[model samples]
Target: MMPSDAPPPLPEDLFAAARQARTNAYAPYSRFKVGAAVRTADGRLFAGANMENAAYPQGQCAEANALGAMVSAVGGQRIIEVAVVGGREDDPQDLCTPCGGCRQRLREFGTETLLIHICGPDGRRHTTTLGVLLPLSFGPDNLDIV
Candidate 1:
């Protein structure tokens, strides 16, 4: 088994998985498709596609879906790396970063150093860390619940 703290592997296939998941997005309302794939410290991969709802606020982001999948898995909660791809269906080129809510959600399960790989159909365009995306944020640890 790989070490518990090993750095996440940056494989091109991770981006490929996100891109492929983008094709399955249910974004009929905004026509904006987003896909997200996350790699845990344990070397597991999970992918998710954005789903929209007419109610708008009820819509689920791709990142949330991916994170949900990871959380529902057997073990491991630390996401070492994430790949996200999103854009208008006709032209998928915008450097679609995770929204503020998703960023906070990510921070709940990832360290400040967790890598967020922003991708387009062509491939990765930028890479940022959770600290850079959501600086001085609140998380599970912030809760005082016993």
Candidate 2:
């Protein structure tokens, strides 16, 4: 069980996870590094970072990589919370939010999941929901085939 006062994985912790993922990233082009951390419903944490390619379209988003890691690690479990960050250095000073495709992916797995975006040295955080991230989102509910 997660500790009651687990402090929601401090900004530094999140940054560490992101940075770790960043290190494993296979970015051969577009040095725009991104990272993601996902918390499983059972409280397991998984992290992933952006992997760019010379082909551009072949690149993978940080969120997608994180989701893949989470799925592979936890089997089938809902994601509770997710944090995404990016920077040239592993500093928690420069971060950004997930892109549109990432948001949609989040909504598909957990529509109500908490998405946190942190930036700056002070670890200023912006909290939002997948619903807000993907307004009028498409999901399993939207697809019907008989």
Candidate 3:
């Protein structure tokens, strides 16, 4: 068991899980595998890999998958941080950030201050916030729903 006051897992630790998740990606079309991990406020981590489909746009991104797992296991939990890792073995420009749609999807669960890390499978890392990734974005509050 971890101490209550123990520091949350480091970015690299989350990236490592994302890297492992990437191996399970089902990307036969684009061949671009992506993995994502989400850390909840309580330090719980959930990881997911991209699943592609032959039918266009009938696939789920790694970020969405991770968020789905997080919410399914812990309803009403807010995501505090997110780390995404992806790329191809042949042309490795990993440091994969959430796509536009994924960013919006994440906004549904994470606050504007949520930390986001884009990382390569080899451990390259970059950090930013959801607000930075999607500035002045429309969200639940925009509709007076939050």
Number of backbone collisions per candidate: 0, 0, 0
Candidate 1 per-residue lDDT over residues 1-146, each given as its tens digit: 02235434557878888898899999998888899999888888889999999999999999999988887874447788899988543444568999999999898788788898887777776677888888898877789531
lDDT of 3 by residue, 24-77 (tens): 999999889899999888989999999999896899999999988888888757
Q: Which candidate order results from sorting by lDDT in descending order?
A: 1, 3, 2
lDDT of each: 0.83, 0.67, 0.81
Candidates ranked, most accurate by TM-score first: 1, 3, 2
Q: List CA RMSD, all candidates.
A: 5.5, 5.5, 5.8
Error of 3 at 141 (Å): 3.2
Off by over 4 Å in 3: 1-10, 88-94, 143-146
Decoy 1 TM-score against native: 0.84
lDDT at 36, model 2 = 79
Please write out the lDDT profile of model 2 over residues 12-49, one tens digit for every residue.
66656766676676766776767778777677778987
Error of 2 at 61 (Å): 0.9
lDDT of 1 at 44: 83
Instruction: Point out the worst 10-residue segment of candidate 2 by lDDT.
Output: 1-10
Off by over 4 Å in 1: 1-10, 88-93, 143-146
Candidate topping TM-score? 1
